[model samples]
Target chain A: MASRILGRLPLDEDRLAQDMARLAQAPAPQEPYEVFTIGRWVNLNLWNASGDDGDGFFNGHRQVAGRPTRLLGGVPYIGELLTTWFNTELLTMVRARNVVEWSIVPHRDFLESGPAEDFFRVLVFLEDNEHALNSDEDMVFHMRKGEVWFLDSAQIHAGVNISSRSRWSLCLDFKAGAGFSPGDVFARAGDYDPAIRPALVERAPAPADLPDRLRALSAVVSRHNIKDIAFLLGKVHFTEEVPIGASWDWLVEITRASGDPALLDLAERARRFFVHSREVYEEFSFVPA
Target chain B: MASRILGRLPLDEDRLAQDMARLAQAPAPQEPYEVFTIGRWVNLNLWNASGDDGDGFFNGHRQVAGRPTRLLGGVPYIGELLTTWFNTELLTMVRARNVVEWSIVPHRDFLESGPAEDFFRVLVFLEDNEHALNSDEDMVFHMRKGEVWFLDSAQIHAGVNISSRSRWSLCLDFKAGAGFSPGDVFARAGDYDPAIRPALVERAPAPADLPDRLRALSAVVSRHNIKDIAFLLGKVHFTEEVPIGASWDWLVEITRASGDPALLDLAERARRFFVHSREVYEEFSFVPA
Candidate 1:
């Protein structure tokens, strides 16, 4: 799985800081929550499918439960700003406040059951501290304040806070049919003033398990998975010390045996470019001269 | 054009060095030669099509012109060593001795006319200095003593001796149908003792002219040139900031417009892998953000 930085939001830092300070001074959670084994982290649901303040079912069509009395406290500026910035039909909005030294277990959302298409989860960091969102394939995103990201919820991810002070973030879930995508956000982010634009750092994921992963993918060959599997084979050929002939042979044999013309064509292209020595040498016998 | 380090040859370095020393002490070239305006370098033809001593046609079947009178004068070790090492039917042989502070202009070999297939030119460096052979895509190979290389004659290449000491190398041409290839040599090179293996340094070629090159290739769409043109497009897409979508779009349009299904399939495979962001972003407008 690959994750990209969609871009940053343009929120006035001074006003956001003031709003956060006011929210922090509010009288605790307006509703009770269950404690977990890791630590005590509180969730304030601003909107959900059910009108109640309790943590409601997190999927399907949702409506604004009620006014954000605990944080917004009848204030209209922040709500208007969020509604305008997101520019979509809001399904659910939640303020997740993580206690110091606490972390959420890695897990995927809306996997077992969900709508036909995938939805987007946009995160707006309220306070800056040593907190990170670790996702699939060991990708870590150290989100900073005033930054916005469209997190891929299908991938297993976790939110962690190891700062001395508590951390807070606003997570907004928009309906998949809202006609918004990460690509749009990414392009829009580039339009922001350079001074306040958030930095997007993408780390190349380590391929320690690539061999095993490739083997697994090859075992279950299908049209949907063939492209990715072929790409991985090319990646392995170029970046690894594995013999080029061996890789070419494997791809040729597997794709041919699968009897998929597309895969076979892909294999041919892979041979032409990724696998060197295809053009110059017909048979590369290792006999020393 | 791309060049690969096919492999290394095994030779008795001590005996070869002794023969080189004996050859160096010899008076001068045993045959007549021509001096070019580029530099003071000289060519001594050891063998050619004609029995007379002169630089004859460099390709096709040939016989030894005469004895290597100056270097191999009464010395059988070097001749026997070369005959045994090459171990194939020879077409032509020449002793290229470059004077100090001289260079050869960049050019391709056998471009005007040649056999149906390409021939191999094996260079055995008799004396080593700070000399280099620059070839396709800015690749440079520094030939060392007792080292043999199958130079890619079809690509533009040049030899340079920047050092004050004169450089000498024996050039041997072998029939391409002799069942020897760079791939076979490259695979076998790994078995050689690491110390004797020549270093192949590849420099990144500037892609400033890539767009123009690609345009020219698209104009002359032929089966013979399609593969190379596709490979170059892949190279540009992977290594350059040119948007992958743009590349895919151009390839699809050109190959389809050319009415070549094979090229179209090749373009499809290219888009599947080399052109990233293909599946993610559909409409990649080149407009900034």
Candidate 2:
């Protein structure tokens, strides 16, 4: 499936409490400086390359010294739950992300991670955050606590947590065996719940003259607001009827109208970096000057 | 008398067309650099100190050499209209403002404009813009073409033009005589139409925990989005059930949460400037560094 709910994990309050306590004490490895984030979005790794608890940066399992996945020293509850509820041998990387009053800009993942069939991604919400939302290219959705979603990260997507409380979720990346299918993995892992369904968000239709309306931003676009405008445009896709790439197009138009060469150049580069191609550790800043 | 519609001007399409043509060719004196503006909000003067059309900056009539208002060299149509419709002897300053996809941040005006009764402010819409809105401390409203509004600029207020089309309005300031009232000026000027009533906006009540929700911005506040956040906060007061000053309080909280000393300092200064005291030509920038 491109992006759909896989199953629901059995809610274990005791285990969840323990995991929450452990995560609260865990030190965030880094403050991500990438274009995809706009707030304090932190990540804690439970399993990844080097097996170092401090190594929270994303490194594909194949690119590191460690041949396969290894459980980090800390976060025993997450490790136990993963190993018990899923086939840990097939897992490549597992991270617990915490977002509080933050947003992840619209982006696609795994551009260079080989064939799409070789990769499998799953996101599991750890708590009920009414104010959180996740948007794929097609639709905006809300995932409840204990929901296991098979996320097609290869597609354009974004996330937002607008609440004062934490929106904690687990991101797991798996490597499929030769000619692997989701059913085979589910049978082996015994984690599938066929009865569970995803909850989708309903949004009002975007105005017909949205492009013309959006061009109005050009009159106000400036260095101080380049990123905010980008974020706002990115959000319009999920909230309105516009396509994900439409935001970048609007950005280009807005910056060009600004009559500022630097902003114009930055908008063009941002369009490329965000929708076209982005390398590991490559960051884009609106005010590079 | 606080913030209400004074009357409706007779719609003269020919004069409006001619004015529009002239305004299109007229050079904008300056792009306003103040806490109140966020886009290309331009003002052209027809009457002011020095009687120079090029002198578009705002200097209260009393502050300049010309005790009363003086017609500028150019823009004879605007000067003629003001002279014919109102008592020019009592007028202090007259300006034509054009806003396209721009917004004036929520702010209180006439903080030092002497006694409230002595100063009379009127705004006349030159065209119909569906996306335009004006908000006072109490409510948001829309003014149609040829409508004349008695604006109490002393109260907290803001303006927004979300359309790509120009939102042009005439700002007329008058220095009232002793024991003055809006009735006395209208009787003297022959500009009042008693039948017109202001169309007030209907808004839902603000959420109970809006302050808590606003504080969430602190988690994501940064130099790149400080102004956007401030503007967003400013707009919220107009759109939601929050007081005008609440935006500043939220700004202060958001900046303090950012842990950025520069942003924090700017927010405090902005609070003081926009709502409290502002000297002539004083400007505020979100990203001064």
Candidate 3:
């Protein structure tokens, strides 16, 4: 009985369902949030928030020190019966995250040099919207979601919005968190080979608890060079170093999205009970859920 | 909405839990009949007396001819809670039929074959003595279950079991069913050429309810010198056929496994409304589940 708790967000099923139906009938999305339907995407829940809104919700990503940043919100969204059903039926709790209006690419008024670079441009549909994300592959699906085509962020990919539909999805990402791949930031930063090191498989059993694809991915990420700091992370990375803007709420969100709240909490409790790693929630750079 | 009853069996949740735990600890089976375990089996609710039981279930193949067979009682066994959780979480209702007892080689006697024709043996472990299975092979994953290699059925290609410990998993033998490719049956029959024939996607819109894989297969099945009987399957083959077996009761078991009686009743109504096509039911074979 090893288990831990992470974050929780309320889900709104009706709104999600309505959005799903609307998006279903809407045409394929395009360059400037044009079309709204076609392809496969169904609603699971809804949350209260929008782009740059103050109700503690976010819609867009920001660039800091040449790095992209995510806004804060407890990762869990409300009204989704699937995760609960999964836990109750399977007896295995999962980590998960929440999404509100985070767009893959900002629907600029057409003349903004097609959005920024260093950022991704996906080429496929994001749940509801049927536009090819210009290499902007942001979503990841777990076993509970048919387990195919779900994108893992660490992988090199991008997308572009070729359709004209509002691009919105309550995206959640999940994975096990442990001091495995994200080695002790305390360890000299350049000491470990960013690409060839092993994951926290022993330290962060999170990958162990996750689905095979993610688990295999953890291995792949471990072997691949970090390339850039913002893109590479491990459960242990947070244990060693402090990064600006990382929030406990963000940790909760990532874990929540992993579909296992229990493990997220476990990471926190592990630091508290064993490592005496007493740091505020928002201090750590990242938490692998 | 479109739905159907899977089946009702002696669904003892507590007993099932206890059985799962006990079986996880059980050793390799000594005999083939031990794998069958009785008291548990294919739930009649999901399927009806119809067609042949393709080797999808792996343990054996049952293709009844002339007369319809009696549908049995039970729930779809996914080898263990681990698998059940993965499947219930990933594919929602996708099943994994682990190899256990079958016509060619019974349980522990697997060693007699010296080596299996394929690497991924459809062997099952005792989870409180329940059965488990897996069929589709869209991707392959390599990882761990408490430090051991974990197998993913999504990727096609066979595997060799070179472990000293028992590997209990749902055996899923993917024989392209009544839908497409004419399967080993047709290829072996030499009635069609695998390379010459265009794949299923090249065909027309298949039965709406069937998964794309199965729909393609349905197209293949129809191409058989068996078109008349195949189309009589109408939407039935697509809707009525369960991953493991095809029977009216299979409908019931799926509903029951959902643990929602309302859904259960939904399936039951379908059974009554569209009485079993006796001629067709008689033709269906019981696959290993």
Q: What is residue B89's positional error in candidate 2, in angstroms?
A: 66
Write model 3 residue lDDT over B1-289, tens digit each, in one string: 0011111122345655554444333221112121212111221111212322211122212322111111111222322332322222111111222222111100121222222222222222232221112221221122112111122222212221111122333322222223322122211233222232111111123344443322222211111111111112221222122321232344455445546566556445534433322221121111111
Better of 2 and 3 by TM-score: 2
Off by over 4 Å in 3: A1-232, A235-267, A277-289, B1-5, B12-18, B27-176, B179-289
lDDT (Cα, tens digit) per residue for candidate 1, span A1-289: 3444455666776777676665554322322221110222445555555444444345433333323434444334556566566543443554545443334433345443354245667677776774343333334556786677666666544454433355777776665545654544332344433244334335444356544434433333443233323323322322233432444555666677667777777666545433232321122111101
If the candidates were sorted by their TM-score against the true structure, best first, what order would they fall in? 2, 1, 3
Q: Answer with 1 or 2, whichever has the higher DockQ.
A: 2
* Candidate 1 per-residue lDDT over residues B1-289, each given as its tens digit: 2443334555676876676565454333322221110222444455555533333344343323333433344345666755555443443554545443334333345543354244667676766674434333344567766666667666545554433355777676655545655433222334333334446644444457554444433443443233323323332322334442354556666687667787777666545433232221122111111
| Chain A TM-score of each candidate structure, as shown | 0.54, 0.89, 0.24
Clash statistics: count for each candidate:
2, 0, 160
Quality of model 2 by C-alpha lDDT: 0.68
* Segments of candidate 1 deviating more than 4 angstroms: A27-37, A61-77, A112-116, A131-133, A177-180, A183-289, B1-289
Q: Is candidate 1 or candidate 3 better by lDDT?
A: 1
